[model samples]
Target: MVGLGTMGAGIAETLAHRGLAVVGVERDHESLRRARARLAHSLDRAQGHGRLDPPSREDLLARIGLGTDLAAVADCDLVIEAIDERMDAKAALFARLDALCPPGTVLVTNTSSLSVTELAAGTGRPARVLGMHWFNPAPVMGLVEVVRTVVTDPDALEAVVALAGAAGKTAVVAADRAGFIVNALLFGYLNNAVRMVESRFATREDVDAAMRLGCGHPMGPLALLDLIGLDAAQAILASMYEQTGDHRHAPAPLLGQLVAAGLLGRKAGRGFYPYTAPDSGEVVGTGTAVGTGTAVGTGTAAAVEVPPVRRVGVVGSGTMALGIAEVLARSGHEVIVRARRPDAADGVRARVRTSLDAAVAKGRLSEQDRDGALSRLRATTDLGDLGGCDLVLEAVVEDLAVKRELFTDLDKVARPGAVLATTTSSLPVIDCAMATSRPEDVVGMHWFNPAPAMRLVEIVPTVLTGETAIAGALGLARAAGRHPVRCADRAGFIVNALLFPYLNDAVRMVEANYATIDDIDTAMTVGCGHPLGPFALADVVGLDVTLAITRSLYEQFREPAYVPAPLLEHLVRAGFLGRKTGRGFREHRRR
Candidate 1:
């Protein structure tokens, strides 16, 4: 092992515990001491958990030999380096190891991300050096990605794979590339989430909540960024952007600022959110700081002053409409819900009441809250009833023609200067604008599913949309207690635009059997730190919805890559509508 920080030490401890003699070489005495201490602590924990017996821990400790000499690993049949990410430093060490070790000795770099080919060629024995990346707290993380260069010896690759198995880590073989498979896919999503916050689209809390609840993610993007040091994460992403030239991996400005400020992560004194005291594990952020009551904003969100909003109008009566109405009423918006017909409107109102009451039963909402929320709700069969309403959100069906007709009708009847917004998740703002003669008066306000719970609301706008319209809609979403991300009119917009293609890729991976469903899910959740695997997320996102978005992207891009996966079609045909249908990749076989 070459560097003895947290990752290296964990890897060494894991190897030693598996009865393998580990020769760990660090440059300086202080570094060597830290590595040795970390390894001892890891082994002690393994003993405490009954995973390793006391005698085994002692043996494991005795087996590990720490040194500053590269020749120390000369006699070993296989050597793994977990050094600092500098190419020059690693190249120098590998050259020395290649000269000292026998030709058959397999060499590996436990680099999470770096070019394997470049690193491999650093040693004179190009066929020997490949990558054997370990996850943090490696003994427990259960993953080791073995990256192969084109020139890498097959036997060397096989030996590393066998060694990973011996060390009790799951191994995946991958082509050498920037960010490789895991971080390439992961960081793009994280960067987008940051842009969402940077643009004042949503608060960090709402953004994280929307992802966790709506998509079943374990942690929100912002929290994940804090965990993965902002500096290191940006470096990984910047490498991808430089290699692939994909704009998605382009580093957000805040990443550089935070890193420069030394607010790197839990290791640093602070990060995107600060830790009260690093070792205390108590973290605080803008809205959630210790000893502070007020929230910070980007001038705009701070300036938004919500009017004494009494009655709110909703121009649809579907589940989305009902959900929005319930959430609104629950938060004290006197909901004037409109459906096309009297029975439909009444049905929506009843559903909203039942939802509220269920919350009461679940102790999510008290009886007083349920009553207060319901007291403000009123069902209407007329759009004209919204004539004097302070705000009107159109949660109608997502057809452009249907939404345009409603907007035209509302254009004539809505109270002058009342915010006319569409909760159309996928439609363009300009298309919705053409329907209303006053295009500047219209904007897009999207809410995630189960509106009462999900907090993200993308406030999309066309060029014609006025600042006042943007401000008013943004204010309403915030007042409704939603994190609203603002964006220009585009197909699929931000979340779906980026998220759907990834889902399609997962479908492709499954179709290829590159990994089993369980393996892929585990690789993502445990290996890459995702809340759930893409397969699980796909089930929750719904096969039908995923298919629609994939087809839409294909229609726009005309790329074979964006084509919908056949498995998705078959699943939808089979009526496996995820948790709702109680069947998907894994059966949601009741409580």
Candidate 2:
């Protein structure tokens, strides 16, 4: 192992833990001292956590030999480089190692985004060179991206894969590309988040919260960027943009400005958010924690005083409508669900009962609570029944025309001062508002699917929307135990705006024959700590719905990157909607 920095020390520890003898190298004596201390500290924590016994920790330490000379790696069968992400510096080290090491020794570079093929061309044995990119905190992370150049020998690649498996890490192979598999899909999403913050479309806290609460991501993009040093992020983005020439890969201007100011993430105690000290996880200051306050963007809705909601009306009999009604009823609000037909309304009541019963069975709710919530819910087929509702939420189809027509009817039937909200995910809320005479009363309250479980609710207020309406929607969302984020009436709002584009990029990766579906999914789920890979998530979200959302985003922004992938469109056209149809990027069997 070479360049014993944070990543290097982690990798060295991982290999030594697997019972491999590792010769860890650094630049100088002082640097070598720090590397040894870092390794010891990590092992100490592992031992404290019961992950390693004292004897095993001592044995692992003995397996690692620390030095500051390149000549020491000459006798090693394999040499891995984890140096700084500079092409010139890495190339120089590779050339020097090639001269000193034996002809048959395999060389690996742990680069996140640089070109592996070019690095191989400079070596005396191009076929012996490959990229073995590992995630940070290598001992804990489960992935290692094995990048294979065109000239990389098959035997060398196999040896690396076997080694990774023996070290308890899953290996995914990718062609020599700019970002390879993970960073190619990950950094683009991260850059888009930075652009969202730079444009003031959403606050940094809101962006992170949307992904965490709405999409089930382990960490929000901005916080993850802070954890990854800002300077390092900038370098990766710059490398990706230079290679791909895609403007989306270009680092956002705000990122460049932050780097220029030396606010390089947690290492500097600041980046997107302030930390307690350098290299600390304890964030400082107000409004940095999630769910503390409303994340209102510039020109977006603000929190204001509004009348308390006592009675709520949910329109439609679909899954979303039933889920929303359940949440409202459980929150002590009288819920009236209006369906198009009497049978549909009855179906809504029956489904809610079943869901509540399951919750009771799982000990998530008490029998008394379930009975009380059900008693508070009513179902009807008349629009006139919603006249006395304090707030009416429509969870109808995605068709804009259908929503506009419903708003027209709701305008005549709903009582004055009642908040009218649309649950559209991608359509314009302004269009629905304009269909009603009381445009000031209409606002967008987007709820994620399975509304009773997901806590995110994007509060979108149109230009003509009233402050009373915004406040009412925000208050109601909080009352239902949901996190509300305020943004302007725009296509895709917060979560979908950032999410679908990343899914589209994954589709493009498969379309270009750069990587296989399973490999890409494994890379993301294991490498980035995502709950699901992009393809698996797209399948669960439905390909047709994914296509529609991406189309709406492209129509609104006219961004070429937002254009839906041909493969996705093709699957939708072939009637492979997703898990619903038992087919998508991968096949599924119905239970």
Candidate 3:
């Protein structure tokens, strides 16, 4: 291993612990000493954790050699380059290794963002050069992308893959390109987060929480970028943007600003969030003191007293309405649901009863609790029945006109100062607010599907919305055990705004045939640690829904990146609406 930085040291430790005779090379004795010390610390930690016994750890360390000369690996069978990401430096190192090492020796580079083919072609032995892109904290992360250039020998690729496997890492092979697979998709998402904050769509904390709680991501995009080092992330993103010419891959302007200001994340003790010390994960300051654009209720909702919400009214008899009603009733609120027709109201009540019964059978709800919740919920066709509601949530279809007209009715029936909220995932909440007489009482309470199970609820406030309404919506979300992330009344709000574009990009990738559906999904899952790949998620969300959200984003933003993928439209046109129709980018079994 050449260039013993953190990644190089980790790689050295991984290989040594796997019983491989390894040599770590650095530019000078000081560098080599530092690398050795780092490896020792890591090994000591492993031993303390019982991952390695003392004798085994000593034996492993004994098998490793350190050197400061290129010729030290001349007789070795392999020379893996874990050097800096600069292409000129990598090319120069590879040329020297090609000259000094034996002709049969395979040369591997552990670069994550540079072009492997260009680097390989710089050496006389292009066929022997390959890339082994390992994730950070190499010993901890299981993934190792074995990148093969066009001129790389199949034997050389096989050797690297075998080596990665022997070192107990999951190896994924991809053609040489900027970011290969993981960083390609990963950085685009991260850059979008920066844009979200830069544009003030949401604050850093709320953006991070949306992905963490909403999507099950371990960290939010901005937090992950902070951990990645702002300068390094900007470099990788610049490389991807220059190579792919995709605006989505372009580094957010805020990233460059932060890097220039020396707030390069955990290393600098500050970036998106402030830290108490360098390399410390403990954040010190509140993240509300952000740049330009409205704060969007990120850090904490204001201290205003949330209006009482004992009696709640839900309009429409759709699945969303039933779910919302169930959530409200279970949360100790008297939920009155109004449908357009008596039969529709009856159907809504029946569905809610069935869902509660199933919950009881599954032991998710006790028999008494289920009965109590059912008694609190009532369905009616009379819109006047909602007159006594303290909070009225509209869970109608995703049509602006229909919602506007419903808001006009809700304003008249709901009592004075009643918080009027719309669960519109795609439409603008302001349109509904404008239709109501008291726009200050109209806010958005966008819930993810299966409101009872999903934790995220976007509390969107329009310009006309009041503080009390926002607080009430936030309070109601908390009452139902949901994580409330506040944002402006923008199209797609928090989750859908960030999520749909990614899904569309995945569709574009499949349409371009750059990779198969399985390859893309596997690359994201194995490479980025996403709970599910974009393609799989699109299928689960329904391709039609994905297309509608994508269209909404495009129509709202007018950005080329948000444009709906032709493939998505084609699939929807062909009646392949993902899991609902059992067919989409990938086939799914009918539920």
Q: Which digits, one per residue and each the tens of the lDDT, describe model 3 over residues 1-591?
A: 898999999998889889999888899989888998898899888888989898998899897888897788898888888887888899899889988988899998998888888888888888998989888899998888888877889899899999999999888777776787678667887888888888887878888999888887878988888798999999999999888898878888888898889999999998888888999888886745335355564434468886567999998888888998998899899999999987897787689989999999998999999889999999899999999988999888888899999899888888899999988888988888999889999988988888778899888888778888888888888888888887777888878888887787777766765556776787778767889999889888898889988999999889897889998899999999888898988888887
User: Candidate 2: which stretches are off by over 4 Å?
Assistant: 287-303
Tens digits of lDDT, candidate 2, 41-82: 999899999999999998999999999988999999999999
For this target, which candidate reaches the highest TM-score against the unseen true structure? 2
Q: Candidate 1's residue-wise lDDT over 482-544, tens digit each?
A: 777656566676667657767776666667654457756767776866777888887877777
Candidate 1 vs candidate 2: the lDDT winner is: 2
Clashing pairs for model 2 are none
Candidate 3, residue 182: how far the Cα is off, in Å: 1.4
lDDT of 3 at 173: 75
lDDT of model 3, residue 575: 98
Q: Is candidate 2 or candidate 3 better by lDDT?
A: 2
In candidate 1, which residue pairs get closer than 3 Å at backbone N, Cα or C atoms, i.e. clash? 201-484, 201-485
TM-score of each: 0.76, 0.96, 0.94
Q: After superposition, how far is residue 349 of candidate 3 from its true place, in Å?
A: 3.5
List residue ranges in candidate 3 displaced over 4 A.
287-301
What are the Cα lDDT values of the candidates? 0.76, 0.91, 0.85
